[model samples]
Target: MCHMTACSLLSYIAIAWMKMVPMQTIRSRVQFFKISALSLVFCVSVVFGNISLRFLPVSFNQAVGATTPFFTAVFAYLMTLEREAWLTCLTLVPVVAGVIIASGGEPSFNLFGFIMCISATAARALKTVLQGILLSSEGEKLNSMNLLLYMAPMAVVFLRPATLIMEENVVGITLALARDDIKIIWYLLFNSALAYFVNLTNFLVTKHTSALTLQVLGNAKGAVAVVVSILIFRNPVSVTGMLGYTLTVFGVILYSEAKKRSK
Candidate 1:
């Protein structure tokens, strides 16, 4: 949770820096609102994603996140009226199955955790769809930097209150930072920089790739993050989980090939 919060703060700072650069193109209030709303969805998703992480192992969390392509397809279908091929639909089955298998037999299900994961996935899907629409309509007017700038500060509206009320020790940390916790300050600074990079990558990826493809790649990210966490944080990794990750990677590669051929 702390990691997620730190990431969020970093993302916001990145967005703010992007927004500072003046752009010749102008957006209407409605378009700006849409972008802002999308940012809010992103913020909410990260929060829920973090919360879900507490109940499930990091491996499980990433496995579930591997289903992002499935959610992205759903959202794209609903929002853009984009219809995926039957083959594409079929591809998700193995991916989802792999996630279930990776979860190590659902070790004592937590309803809230499951819900949070689903919410995060849904939010990510929605963001993809909405962003696609916005970019298609107004992309020429908005560079990635401008988009980040507008989005970063707007996210603060949601992040600030939530962090203040929900995060117990956040206030103390903030005070300590003010009082000269150089390490904490450094941590926060580094996190903020990482957040910006992630956000930038997200925008670039979404702009260049299909939403479904981007989401599919997101699975790989989850798997990698999980592996890193396991090695660094000493998180448990079961045999089934390893097998599941392998399957997911294979399925994602197959799906990517299919997408490329169709294109």
Candidate 2:
């Protein structure tokens, strides 16, 4: 929470320093409401994502997140009446089945983690869809930096209360951070900078492509994360789980190819 807040603060400063244009791009009531709603969804999604990490093994968490493409497709279709290609739809089959199989076999599975991850995934999909819709209009589109400048502060506002209510070790964390070397502070600042860049890129992607595309990209990234987890964490995996993960990666690739052909 603190890190996110810091990132938002820095982004605002950076935007101002770069003279990124007027901060009044969110000009109308409807735009304000839409941006606010997206911010709230973003806050919940990120909070749940971090919370779920506490209870889930990194491997399982990434596996579940691979399902984001499925949720993205559903939300995009429902929200914008955007129809996916039949082949793309069919590819979702293995994407979902693979996640289920892998999750079922996960040794570190916790029901709470499973639920939180699913909720986060859904919220993330909704956020993506909203960003795509709200930012698609050329006349109303805010540049990626401006979008983040607005949305990040809103996210901080939305998340602060949750942080105060849910975080019990605030004082302990503060003291620990205080006692830590200055290097830790630099690391945190570096991480916050990276987070800002991530937010910028995410908004740019949603602005440039449909939410479904972003979600598909997420699946590919999730596949890479899964591989990294397996390598770094040495997670024990069942044969079924391995097959499931493999299926998911290939299915995502196929989905991307199918979407391109359809386009």
Q: Judged by TM-score, which candidate is best?
A: 2
**Residue range with the least summed lDDT across 10 consecutive positions in model 1:** 1-10
Best by lDDT: 2
Candidate 2 lDDT by residue in tens digits, 121-237: 999999999888776766667777777778878888898888888887886786688687657667867888788878778888888877888888978788888889889989787
- What value does the lDDT take at residue 259 in candidate 2? 86
The sequence of per-residue lDDT tens digits that candidate 1 reaches over residues 109-145 is 4678978987898898888777777656644346565
Q: Any runs in candidate 2 off by more than 4 Å, and if so which?
A: 171-174
For candidate 2, what is the TM-score?
A: 0.91
CA shift at 202, candidate 2, in angstroms? 0.9
For residue 141, give model 1's deviation from the true position in Å. Answer: 5.3
